[model samples]
Target: MNRSTNFVLAQILFVILLLTACSTEKTASDSEPKKKEPKKETVEKAPTEPEEMVKQGAGEHYEKVKDLEGDDLDKEIKELTKDFPKDMKSEDAYNRIIAAFAADHQLAFQELEDFDITFEEVEAYEKYSEEDGEEKKEGPLNVVILLDASGSMAGKVSGTDKMTAAKEALKKFAGGLPKDANVLLRVYGHKGSNDDKDKKLSCESTEVMYPLGAYDAGAFQQSLSKFKPTGWTPLAASIEAAEKDLQGKEGNNVVYIVSDGIETCDGNPIEAAKKLHKSNIQAKVNIIGFDVDNEGQQQLKAVAEAGGGEFQSVSSQKELFDEVESNWSKAMHDARINWSLSMDSSSVNWSSSGKGHSMRKVYSKMLDSISDEFELLRSVKMELYNQKKMTNEELDKLDKLIFSRYEKLREYSTNKHDAKQAALDKETDRVLKLIDENAENARVE
Candidate 1:
């Protein structure tokens, strides 16, 4: 009844108390009667069409039909899509339908670059590429200005003498050429009077007053001052002289002739121009017929054609000055471009027009592709229905779906084109403005 009895009773009481607490915890308590319920887990519903699938588009459609056209296209398509899913369930199945018939929903910008078999090479070959010459290896540039110091050049035009006008233009041109370009000032027929007796001396007189070297303002001015118009024109002989000046020189070579008459020294100017513009010389001979008559214009124009150059006839001093300025600026542009490409591509090797045209071609192809896709889808759908592979309801649903995707693709392609076109136009304008600024800066007079 002492220690043992007391220990056993205490243990029994403790066990009873623990059991009572556990029982109370199982149900609502007096202090906090409300019992908390367990939270139910949520299950999210997936989207009908996945975004990644939409982005992927029915892009494979182009791959299948890209190599086919006309009846052959229809035949190949029918054969390929013979097993097209009749019961469209998964996103993949819908995408397959697009692949079989509809155009791709994703129109990439890379399609605009280079002449690939995927794109029609019409514009690539016909319009833009010809403007781009072959990549040429260059060493230096030679620009020769042929001044016709003939008696006819002493004549007046627009209140200014032809000779004086020619001198000012030549001075500005020679002084403004690119630093790397070598300029030769050639004066023809400056030795004799416009007399029949002095024809031999005048005809034979063609001198390179400012020898081939970098533009020298003072030296060029001195060269200009040393000559005066006093004899008959020696146009052909002058071309030959310029050819001699560029004999061993390399790179882009050019000759500009300021004349008022055709070759009167009995030399063939056209043949001379042909010789100068040969592949070996690679020289372009431009002729400016100042106050020339009809016969002189015809002859000079022919010479320019043979020389792979341009010809213009100016009856006024302003026209003459402008022609010279333009020719000089153009020549300098070519020299500066050493961009190693055609002058159209700009001096930095970016072809603004070319890129624009290519992009436009891409845009056009996109629209045509969309149209072609719609037609193919229509044909494929009708064939499926006729073969009992699909029902009317399925055809209608798929047609609507294909049309919707086509609309989105067209919108996407258009937006992309607009954005790229804006950038191309901006770049084009910038390059042209840069060229113009360069030209203005190069003008010394």
Candidate 2:
């Protein structure tokens, strides 16, 4: 073959050989199955939702009570309210509407063993001292003033009737009451006949004018005018009745028997005192001999011990007014204090340890809100109590005070978003720590 023809023929043979090899390789590659892609893995996650946020102290309190005074008829209807049900009540709703009311007010309900909380309203008085500073003690007082309704007390005692003097003393006592106070008043020797042909032994000389919040000057005076001192002095029955009424209502519940003369009930005074003492009624009784002789004093003192109240004698309206005012003031103060302490204790949550302390801080914050309300309440109460009673102007002032305080409180509560978030963060940390600690303890155990 020529050189050119041999090169061409060589090239063609090389090309054919390359094409066959290429086809075989391509066929081999195509004949082999394609490798499958590896399956993608998936992860499951737990579902969760965010907790609801609430205002710290955003709850409704007494929005209506402002400068309210008690009339004689409606005196007992001052405080009343209903509480939310636990199971059915929504936590969010409670936090929004009732948490403030349920918050503590710094009052503690716990008591140490072996202590009888005394309910004595003793005002510190000036007295000469020896070694220590001046000594002050509750002075002993036994007083009694017979209210004469035999068409006499209706007359004036210094241009303001005898009844007026008594009522003024009572009103003053109510007005000048401390946060804690209690008092009692008994009217007797009225013009109601306890004696009749059929009523041989039945003798009820006096009527209990009012019980607890029933002390009103006008009503009492009106009652006196309507009734007259009829039959003999059923002093024993009156004293006995007073003793029963004073059972649950005394620091050292006492009796001040105001009688014109003698006892008609066969019930003996000294014997009754002994019986009352025997019944675990630690009461003191005193007597006031109203125009009575030494014999009368002896009888009164004996009866006073029986009923567990003191007794004193006042011949004129002046002495009566003064003594009543003094005694009532002391009694009322003591009673109110007892009530205040009780209320305080019942409403407060006491803390002892760390966890308790934290809980207490929460309660304390709540109480702070409550205290603000109470402060406004007390101020409004005082303002209303004065001013010949309450006026619309006074009411407006109270409303303003309450509204402003509430508004400030509401702002404080509403701005607790940051705090709530913080609390949640803290809680998360706490729960984690608790879980870790518990797990560690379990491992150790």
Most lDDT-accurate candidate: 1
TM-score of model 2 vs. true structure: 0.35
lDDT by residue (tens digit), candidate 1, 232-344: 77888889878878878754788888899888889999999998898577888888899999898999999998998877788887877776765446545544424423323
**Per-residue accuracy of model 2 over 173-278 as CA lDDT, tens digit each:** 4445442223355565454445454133335445665453434556545544444434445555555666676565433344444443456556575776666545
Q: Where does the lowest 10-residue lDDT sum fall in candidate 1?
A: 116-125
- In model 2, the worst 10-residue window by lDDT is 120-129
**What TM-score do all the candidates reach, one by one?**
0.49, 0.35
The list of candidate 2 runs beyond 4 A from truth reads 1-202, 214-226, 246-252, 277-281, 305-309, 327-445
lDDT of 2 at 257: 44
